[model samples]
Target: MTITTDKFNTEKAPKPVGLYPHARKVGNLLFLSGVGPRQAGTTKIPGVDLDEHGKIASYDIEAQCRSVFDNVRTILEASGASWMDLVDVTVFLTNMDDDFAIYNKVYAEYFADNQPCRTTVEINKLPTPIAIELKCIAALSE
Candidate 1:
């Protein structure tokens, strides 16, 4: 069998900050780029508290996690997939110690039944002030 790849873009989710599609489908595997809490066509990020100069003041991990998952769901649906199709997910957090519990709680609300394998890591920063981001992979329907 020959493997084919296709790129996906959707206005239903936040536009990619860099030059990349929201997802790329290679055969049955749909690989999604990192999704954050930013809204489409706006600088606003859910759960993020920004200073007057746009520095991160504080954040709500539950809100950020929910928004990130929502964005991921949009992209997945746009690519003809669903939450149940997700096979793996990688989570990024600016503060694991402060955020993991809330983030995990929010995550369970969405994926407890269709739980995908997940890996979460703490990072110093993200491109925006949001506390969370998610990159995922889904198995496309045959």
Candidate 2:
């Protein structure tokens, strides 16, 4: 059987900062590109404050977590799936020591009912000013 892959792009979520589509589906799975907390239709990073030089002065990880979850949900719904369909998630944080606790708390709240495999790691930075990003995969109805 020939497998087909389809790309997904939606207006309900932030337009990707790069050329990639928001998600892609192959066979029975939907793979999402890394989704950040930037608000849809704008570059505003929720709960983030930048200094006069435009560097990260402070940020709220809880806000970023909630926003990212919402963005992931939006992408999932737009791609014909839901939050519970997510099977795997990979999170990138710019500061693990400072942000993990808050991020974890918010993550628990969002995922209380749907427990998906998750791995979170710290990176030096993201492409934007956001504190976190998520890469996800979901099982789609066959």
Q: Indicate which candidate wins on TM-score.
A: 2
Cα lDDT tens digits, model 2, 19-132, are 999999999999999999989998789999999988999998898899999999999999999999999999999999999988999999999999999999999999888889
- CA lDDT of 128 in candidate 2? 89
- How do all models score by TM-score? 0.95, 0.97
Clashes of each: 0, 0
Candidate 1 Cα errors over 4 Å, as ranges: none
Candidate 2 displacement at residue 103 in angstroms: 0.7
Report the CA-based lDDT of candidate 2 relative to the real structure: 0.94
Q: In model 1, which range of ten residues has the least summed lDDT?
A: 58-67
Error of 2 at 65 (Å): 0.5
Candidate lDDT scores, in order, read 0.89, 0.94
